[model samples]
Target: MDPNANKYLLFNKLSSQDAKKKLESETFKRTTLSFYKYVNLKDISFYRDYLYREWDKLKVLGRVYIATEGINAQISIPNYNIEKFKEQLDNDIYLKNISLKEAIEEKDFSFFKLIIKIKKRIVADGLNEIDFDSSKVGNHLSAGEWNDAIDKGAVIVDMRNHYESEIGHFKNAILPQSETFKQELPMVKELLSENKNDKILLYCTGGIRCEKASAYLKHNGFRDVNQLHGGIIDYKKQLMENPKLENKFIGKNFVFDERLSEKISEKVISFCHQCGSKCDMHINCKNMSCNLLFIQCKKCKEKFKSCCSTECKKIIDLSENEQKILRQGSINKNRFNSHRIIN
Candidate 1:
């Protein structure tokens, strides 16, 4: 697919008039909620098509993925249409009343497009069914309970990628030195295998990954396993409800969308990887051909011109035609050549 051709379809930056009209004409405010389930789906393409048609009619917007493994969704819907949407979900026996995590920061139009893509796995673990059982998942803990576990010396592991963890994580959480979600699972198991019976706490951006992860850990003979009830999104809401509950989370929470990240607290826990400067700004490569996401300090940003490194900056400086030939897909595989970009 041409990136430029689908830019408007992928994201609709609402005009002021559209935003005002949505607010005024809609009977109730919209809520952003996310949820995921890891179960065998008979036909992923059929499910995707059904959801696309059903949600489009209800004016729903957000990203959704259906796979042979299960479904993961981050959606926004008007309050009036909430019941209808729930009905649509419940129409399928597999998705009845699944707990949904409401977004901490609700925007009028957070998503302009309703995307439902089919994939092999919902969370991209790259593992077969025998490796992990989603049916026998881990213990779910509330925010307050999670805090108590942390206070009681439970080893907390950030079950996300290196880059996501670099931006924000539990104050003293153990982070795996892995780039992809698939690698983090076994690495986490090895790191905590010695303390099988010890209380183990796990958390991710929206709690979807942790669901299956906790199960995998338990299946591997870890006796005590627990996960955040609604993940960090819920934790943030709890903090807002009680200002006294601040400082539990130490840094920013990385998000997948354009926002890149959201501030969990005033504390800055991460430094720029390139310049060793105090910074938490996560930016993708300015090069259109290689938009690899990474964190860079202001000094490094000035030097590299917002590219991942000098090499990427040089690539972007190439003429349009030359850049096209360089990006023929195979040649660009290892071009960025920076571990910092992955971290």
Candidate 2:
């Protein structure tokens, strides 16, 4: 029997700050990557715990969600242990031969700790299983094929939230204005009702949302539904590998990491929320109570002291104790629940 069988727990023990400090002090380089699959699992809890134990041994760090339907993962692993990590995945039945999408910009670490969560679904779209048959998804087009489709004037729809698209998206892509996937799914359906019969190309940060979305559209009777093979991340990878391919995406691709976005092209389509200057940087308000994620320019960041507004700046100025009291009683009416789209 292994003496340290129970040494690792199913949950992360260190605080995020502490974990980040540990990661910064690490000597070896780490690679950030993401992958997902819509495969069925008999025991999600067992698989989640098994993965946590195994990955923790390899010093892996990132967010992973496992459900009965599937598993979605975004993680960073030490360069030295990448092969070992791959071997671990290969040995596993569920994750074997899973395609990994490496981050374009790896200067900043994506995560500091490993977190395996059990959710009802891998990608939440606020729908029952009956809403859309996941098995009947759109055609997965390769990066080159996607480009060809775009050249052929196929209807392109950005299957991401407003914030995700506001930072970066393909040129002329139908950027949905919804806050969540649940809302965006129906909104997108109606937005393209007129073009239901046309060839539709859908994409997102990764291909998870589009997997569900494409099926939803097909269930609703849309014809010729197709999606970017592995979404923008994979598209960027394909473009990097092949120099001849033209990069159609503009501005930074908004990523859920310490490095907020990655450069897809040398273009800035969005502007600063405060000054209206050409900027695509997204920042959360310094005020903990009003932690609204919005775009701020370098000038406004300095002027507002990394806050969303003068009001939030004032709150941040208060003493820690005073701020606690305000948080206890005050309502965050000024905070924008959805992203602030300052176009």
Candidate 3:
């Protein structure tokens, strides 16, 4: 069904929960995948509208964004229609030969709707086109190569934000404190300013951020920069395929979905912010007014009823009337920051 054939964002009318349940009950399984490229797209609207109509027929669900530069998508293709989806993509001149990374770990409800929209840039890094040459990105290192470089003393850096790194990251990686990628760009420059000539390694959730980040670093006169070929998702797949590939990356990897996280190693590297116990599970505060995302343990989750702090806990405990009034003037962080931006 072409939900948006007659209007804009027609799928928004459907209840997300309702659509999710329908997709879950389908006979065929769902295969979650993501990919990106730096090709120039002329008509953003035509590209977006065409994909929405065609992909929807194949029972594809998930988010997709097309910009003047390229596309960034985290989509789920129905098992039966996987070949059809691929065939259509390969046939398209712009999308042909693009790499698609399948999720190493995916749930049935990873996504529930199909959305395609036009954006300014595929990944917003707050960089002008004149600043860096996107074509001249860093070297792409495989899982084995990345591991070897780290073993040989390459300065590893986590390209994700502080909240993401708090749950899990490769050991000895320099994780900046900034929340957004825009802020992270300059912060990384300053953190490694003195060692600009040394070997620098970067990795993110799915490699998109690292692609842009590596280029930015190189533009800033950094020498010998490298990035994981497919980010942590590919790294985990490699470890599973080869038992001898000692998993240097510890703890859960923060994801942008209902699953929220995927475990890479058995080791827990972070403590719950509320109780300080060894935990890596992330939960949003229950209070709609202040739904800050933070790591929380089972004990703390139960004690605080899933709220982040005492202030938020009290707000959630109030009557519905009072809670609504309080939310009128406050920023409603009830949704995940990443999900909100795409939607």
**What TM-scores do the predictions have?**
0.80, 0.93, 0.90
Q: After superposition, how far is residue 56 of candidate 3 from its true place, in Å?
A: 1.6
Cα lDDT listed for each candidate:
0.77, 0.88, 0.84
| Weakest lDDT window of 10 consecutive positions for candidate 1 | 330-339
Output the TM-score of candidate 3.
0.90
- Candidate 2, lDDT over the whole model: 0.88
lDDT string for model 1 (1-343, tens) is 7668833233335764575565466666787778888777887766677777778778787778888878998888877888898887788777887877777665335554567888877887865667566678778887788888998999999998887788788988998978778888889989996889899999999888898788888888999899988888888988788776645787888765435677888787778767777788887777756766667888888889998777889988889898888778734332223235433
In terms of lDDT, the best-performing candidate is 2
lDDT of 2 by residue, 241-261 (tens): 998999999988888776778
Question: 1 or 2, which is superior by lDDT?
Answer: 2
Candidate 2: the clashing residue pairs are: none
lDDT of 1 at 233: 85
- For model 2 the TM-score comes to 0.93
lDDT at 80 for candidate 2?
95
